[model samples]
Target: MANFPLNRRQLIGGMTAGALAPAVLRAHSRGSAGRAVVVGAGVFGVWTAKALMDAGLHVTLMDANGPANARASSAGESRMTRGAYGPDEIYTRMALASLSDWKALSVSAELPLFHAHGVLFFFHEEIDYFRQSLEVHHRLGLPTEELTPEQMAARYPMIDYDGVAVGLFEPEFGAIMARRSVQTLVAQMVLGGLDYRRGKASPLTMPRGPSPLGAVRLDDGSQIEGDIMVYALGPWMPQGFPDILDRKIVTSRQEVFFFAPPAGSDDFSPAKMPGWADFDAGGLHYGFPDLEARGAKICFDNHGPEVDPDTNPRQVTKEGLAEIIAYRDRRFPKLRGAPLLETRVCQYENSSNGDYLIDRHPGYTNVTMVGAGSGHGFKMGPEVGRLAARVALGEDLGEPRFTLATKGTTQARSVI
Candidate 1:
């Protein structure tokens, strides 16, 4: 574990490198006598504050909404949780390491955070991606098994395997109760004595002092000051920090639909269903068990339109719903034409490189910027939170997990 505790000098240099406003320096000085302030009370923000508090730092978590607010992605009912990553070896390792932390937190919070129901990758024909995924899992010592179409149909009768060529199963894979996890984390933060504030944070003036002095100006012009700041504002970051707008992060709007399975298709129930991802279609097809009474959930992976995060997320169009229904009809005939119960639109703050950005601000050492979720960040939220906390504390990041592309190397293409 690389732990880099930020000293006064390093903090100043980091802030300068990121070209942050001078107020950032004054607000984050270690010499300041105050608690650490985490902006945005989403999963990342709350967990970051909790980590800091556990490390003996007084924490003040400020967010625009209350816990599990719909404005944040962390409010989703569930997120697919799996560890059989293909070429992304680093992410697989991070997930494995995070399991312990998640389990510990689940126990402490007395909440069921994970469901080890396994995951099934259904593919048509012998695809290279599937082969590569199986190879990678084997090479990484992960438990995985291949199934023939007959075997798959026998095991998962709900799946229409008429044209399916192969299936890959990872018994260790599962799903996470995302909203519950967020609630648990927030509860732990409160239990640990972290202060909570609800308000929008704008740039604020810093008090004149030699010590670190930062203030978050709220909507009412009231300022909340702190010794150090953690910028976990998620998609709202672009408005708060405009300097890095062009450097790569952008918000994309995605929608998920829930539908009632066809009558007699109880096999799709949570007790028997595992998460499924299909690449046989032109695009990625992913779905999760609907454990929150919202019906079986399904969505296209990385095929959403770009949008501004501040706008309402309820603009899902009739065309979008049609596309989803068509997908279900073609790939999952059982759920085809099922009654649509609900739809959820969420924003993904993506990086051009398709990897997470968990580092100190180039110009502001005292402030750490956490964004670029890249669509697949929810599963690793706790690990990313831990890493963000370590960065804020000035701890050295150990071996990099995923292959993070720098601005110089990343091309001007969509992350998907």
Candidate 2:
């Protein structure tokens, strides 16, 4: 039998136990000074809610499946985080700021969510993106080293660096336990006085006309008015606002595999190995060093075909499995036929241009909608939340790329 991950019951129980603080589930207190309602409790929504609440707003956070829902793109076990966004230093700077936030939140929660195991970038030839990334890293004074093929071969024997021109290694950048971290943040905030509701909410409507922000229409026929509303629903944006997001946001299936290392072998252990990204001749592949003896995590970054979050089947295709195995054989020679530990089928919310969409709704000034993670937005969530909150309060983000005007129906992924 495949080594299964935590069942639904176990995950929920563990989350509840981990969240030791009492949270108010009530919504729309008439006496509250300022009220804000945020939909979708994934990474974006959770963090925005936390930021709003921290700013002394009585915030109501509603999600259909709560934080880290299995169907959500942010529901994965781990996500890689680094400061290199090709030559784009905006994201690199944002990443540095977000990393500080991640560490701070983890410290506050008493959970080791951000693991700084370092990230290794692999290249088989002259890859412009890799070169540009290195330039940005060097310019920012971030710690990075160019490893010769021979050096990489000696340091990481597991990688098949054949025909590789060079490898760039960024020290102290690593992966975060996505689900646990999301759960921990929202959980801790809930314990610290965040009002979290396990319910679905819609933003296209309002109960009163004074402010277009209006009231959120709940699935249960209840209305909760808020001074501001934020929709960070990820893949569900198309479902809720088909007219607006059907063309702007695209959701695609992403498959991941974890292969157990050879028995008792320390080769792939976190202490010895670093997380790797292979932008090689064949394709783009990435994997993390074994953590907690959970084997190396591997996945392809290509945005798979578009998919619907609610209806698409969440299982890996046999062809997909074969393609992944081929990478294993070429990359980690020792783990070619290792036991398949667990499988996860997740999705990515892609904006047309692959940049995060963080703008107020075109029609409703009081409502802000965010989506298009483009498979790499997890690490930026901390900063995104604070930015979205700022936008709702009429603060200029100074980021033209995140505006809705840049988002379109045509898909061309340029952001790395």
Candidate 3:
């Protein structure tokens, strides 16, 4: 799927009319009519609601957290939007489709949801992983260019490419404003007459003969019945659905730190400093341009200790800050002495296989499950939501890819 420009009117139509509080309530009430209950208002849930509304279904979106709260994973500032799948062609295809949907949704929501500043994968020497990434990009026909160390330094002078041998640059890959995207999707859902509810859903109460459908009991014993239920709950997967409790979906806490860019560095802005990932260190180290001008946001890919989403501390610790600082000093010499401005933690609801689990509940047809996005799932949330909606609508989703079922397994609880 190629990227298509969004229409101007659609872009303007995505803005919210009133205050966010009332608009969310109104959206929830308006969408409660026809009979679709989408649990979880994270990025996936919001987009799922929008997609359902577009398909003419009265969609009700539910989440345990309050509106636009940072409790969930989608509350982060930015998420990478890259189609260079690094040997996962299926994901690449999905990313291509997702890019198209993201553009359309962005226009409809009237927001600059995407920032196509591109991604630069750095390495000290040519390795098999780089070769695989290059092959995947070539196979997908994505616009990926190989750069020599000198070429990369010349083009992206901000990077410290002292010992770098080669770089892979994907011009179309960039970042997405995750929170804005979710809020915009919810706003558009409201504009399109979708309902947004704030609560946790209990097990479904249904008739005996047919598949389990209708009426999700809330935590407060209140029950809201709908024809279809879409479980887009992120890390709350095990909390909501007990059947998967025994499944291995480990929740881990990860932190990203923001640093003040060096003075007089023109390339520190989003337009000049693209998202970067270095695979040379045997651990994933990535960074994004800070939107607040505090500094470039950077973090390691290593998983933190398992945490319960409800009570675990979401604040970064001094030790975590030290690790990030050490990374800067070791690899990014130019940013060695940068001042740390802020740090925040986010949860990763990862599966055992490191793949997403988007499928109909094995025991129930009316209940659709979309979760365990693992760490890499956010980059593909829009498309995942679309696929989840399709499943909820009783449409054939074709073959599963980047999913747990692909390996003939129902769930792999923890990948990290």
Candidate 4:
């Protein structure tokens, strides 16, 4: 996940839970209903396919590398979940609703996927973001606490509050096991009779004007025709529609590191230390406590250099490792020389303005292009799927911000 500095203008500029309820019914019969073909089995695509299937449509989900693959953005150890978007209430609401669904999923799963460890935000000089988010949280009735530096230290003694001015703690917000959750959701959908295929799909032909597509070509030279099609290819969105999305949706490399805490110490556990984001010196540094015995995970929430997801080498740069190590030592004195246990390299498919692009292609009216996660998309998977399904079904659920018309050629991210 990527987080960037928000200026006053950026902070100023930048949903129903029942409507997103998952219908987990076994596929019995779809009498004359149309077939919906969804390409890319990432978080968004998987949920979109599920929503479409539940809408009484015969749905087919296709992916080249399978769900939660190593290269997929949705394939990660964990992701933070919080309803704080610095005044962006739409995302806040969606995240809140998504957390509800995630809790439900975890309750029914064999192993818990959602970890309710809570999340904290450390606000430094620029407190406008935190203040605005606090207002929204209060209005939404989210259980959040405004804590001073002294209170934060008293609450979380393991973390150093050197430059922190204040803190916002969200008790209900937490982390979700990324890879396992996505895989589990997809597997459950498959067990419920979702037509899943392992193959690469592309537009058979570039149809002119706003016309329905004929078929989507596969790597095996076969074509899958459907009444409606959805392309939620994440980083591959540019490759899928180079003429349009090549510049609109950019893919950037992101690095994450996990360090082993001290032995025989429970202070670094999720129960002792909640997931935290530091906004000191106008930078975003975030991490989670040791979860499921995985080392304390940390990542700098800034977009890295652009990279081709398919070809980029998934190696953490030496500078990145050193930087994270220094940050770890400064924030957690006990882990001054913690050994690195694991590392991951992922790509965030970002839109021009850090908002999602979910709308029908002008040329392919029946085909919906859903992507541009912009780093903070994982937690909104369920709602994104619900909105995508509604759009693919020809419903005019209007939201100007998410439309393709708002996308630009150059990136000027306003949403965090």
The alpha-carbon lDDT assigned to residue 187 of candidate 4 equals 89
Candidate 4 error regions (>4 Å): 1-30, 203-206
Better of 1 and 3 by TM-score: 3
Candidate 4 residue lDDT tens string, 18-125: 232122111122335667889999989998998788777788999999998999999989999988899789898778656767888888899999988999999875
Give TM per candidate: 0.83, 0.89, 0.85, 0.92
Which run of 10 residues does model 4 get worst, by summed lDDT?
20-29
Backbone Cα, N, C clashes tallied per candidate: 21, 0, 13, 0
The best candidate in terms of TM-score? 4
Q: What digit string (tens of lDDT, one per residue) describes model 1 on residues 1-416?
A: 12224232332222122332234334346453246788888777877787677656678888887766887767778787666566666666556556556666656766567767778988877777677778767765667889898888787777677567888887776777777888777877687688888888875232243344356668888987665678887777667667554546677788888888776657777678878888675677788775645688888876377677767567578988888888888767778668988888987777766677776665554677776677777777766776777677666565343223353233343332
Off by over 4 Å in 2: 1-33, 203-211
Give Cα-based local distance difference scores for all models. 0.69, 0.79, 0.72, 0.84
- Whole-model lDDT, candidate 3? 0.72
Q: Which prediction has more favorable TM-score, 2 or 4?
A: 4
lDDT sort, best first: 4, 2, 3, 1
Can you list the residue pairs that collide in candidate 2?
Answer: none
Q: In angstroms, give how far residue 392 of model 3 lies from its true place.
A: 1.6
